[model samples]
Target: MIFILIVTLLIYAGLVFYVAWSGYRGIGIKGNRWFLIAYSIIMLFLSVSFILARFGSGSTLLAVIGNYWLALFSLSLMILPLVHLIMLILRLTSLHREKTRVAAARIAFVVLVAALAYGSYMAYTPKVNTYTIDIDKSYPEDLNVVMFSDTHFGYLSGKKHAERLVKEVNELEPDLIIIPGDIIDDDLEIVEKKQIFNILGGLEARLGVYGSLGNHDKFRGELSELITAIETANIEILYDETVTIEGGLALIGRKDYSEGERLATEQLTSQLDQSLPIILLDHQPYEYDEAEQAGVDLVVSGHTHRGQVMPGNLITNRLFENDWGYLKKGQLHTIVSSGYGFWGPPIRIGTQSEIVQIHINFNN
Candidate 1:
């Protein structure tokens, strides 16, 4: 962990320096040297503060301050690109009048900044995504399934986020809720355990909630304990097992790939009726081809978090057949959510946490 932290800090420091250099090159060394130095120092201090809070001796206050500073720094970083874009646009317009060009550039900058700020606010706000799937099953027509994954339930996702998630799930009037793993982080014992459970229990699902073992859940050695806790909260756990939902839909939960346990496709295949629709809840979406070949009608997964940072989604897409969002592989329908919580850094740079509402319709 210490070595990982050192490597991460070094990478972040390098990124900060690169951004500073880029900004200096754009504005010229003599013109914006002071601005570059100020921004660089701010970025370095914020990065160091956050790293210290995580690994070294630093208080929560320092971390909070660092987070705020980083948020401001992110805005400033956006400003650089927006400014350059505006200048380029003005230059293209053939506006020779210096005063007019400057005025127009200033207006464009303000508009761009305002738009970005609004976008950031909207991105932070909770958004519900609804999807419909026709599985030709005997499930109830109004049966709603609330699916949430990658709720890293630690520093970033606390009681408030869990409560909001519960409230949103309840609003969907779901009959069954599915959490495809990574429900909690490493510090589950020290984290907001009761509050998260309380909110989870408050969910109004008649068929109850189900969870699969995620990588983090296994890493923390809290797999059995978390299952017990969720079961105590009235949610059923299907670890490498299949549970029939009374409506011709078989929900199969598989352990994380890291568990070294082979995919439970054979086990589920033996138990599942060929006439019924089978939905496989696997944490990572990597092995969809096998799942599709195994006759899984739908596969729900998380784990990738859609590259929670910049270029992450692109990289993850390359690694997996379907890393984020929805994809149909032959006869299998696969949906990989970015997730309701974040991992590693609390800040989600390019991806937002999500809850997917899947409405299943039977074909007549």
Candidate 2:
């Protein structure tokens, strides 16, 4: 935990320094003096808030003040990229004092604003992708599986977002819905009070909805509550459990890798009938090799969130074997979803939210 805190502090410090340098470059040293002082104060308050929030004492008056300070801090954070872009434009245009330079800066600013707005809209506007998988079985001929993950329901996403998610799932008319993990943020109680479960309850699937506990869900001490809430909403929580679908297909769910439990890959595979196709629901995508070796036919997961921001996706993709798309390991198919919600900033710089609808068909 101390290691995590230290790493987090280092990252935050790096961001502060980057912002300071960007502001200084954009506005000039003299003009940026006040901005630097204000940003420094915000950073200090933000650091304190981070520490307090960790201990769950971030709701008092001081915490409230800290929260506002962080909000302002975030506002400034949103402006940092713009500042850098402006500075770059200035540097390029300063060499040539042409009227075209002024026009170019205006155009660049307008383009950046439009891009940001469009990206935000895309992040909020969820997309549902339909897919088909062939698993020879004898029961339900036409089965629809709805998969959405990484909702991270807290400050950024709440009841409204849940409602939209429920609405989207209902539209798909799925036989079952699967939420791999990261459905809630560190603060699960906040989402519960927001009646997120009520919204989720409105979603209808033929068999039921099944989900696994994400790292964040376990961290918040709300795993049981979240499971109860979702179950009350008629969705089933399948933590370290297996259920047979109507067509004899096995659906096994494992808790997030970070959760204190055995990997469950071999155990889950050992319990399943090899003849029947097995679908494994895991939160992290890197476990594909294990699932493949265990003879799992398909694996579905979504913790990467496609970085939830730019450049991060590049890094995440490089780290994970199958980061944000479909990969076939021999006969096994693995699908890693970018997920359906934002994590921290609420602003998704690159990736958009998604709902994956999978259809399993029997070739034989």
Global Cα RMSD, each model: 5.2, 4.4
Candidate 2 error regions (>4 Å): 1-11, 24-56, 59-116, 136-139, 219-223
Model 1 weakest lDDT span, ten residues long: 115-124
Best by TM-score: 2
* CA-lDDT, candidates in order: 0.72, 0.74
Model 1 TM-score is 0.74
Q: Please name the candidate that would achieve the greatest lDDT relative to the true structure.
A: 2
Q: What clash pairs does model 2 have?
A: 133-361, 134-361
lDDT of 1 by residue, 116-227 (tens): 4653443345567788877755555545778999887755467778888888889888878888988876555535444677677787787778888788874345457767
TM per candidate comes to: 0.74, 0.81
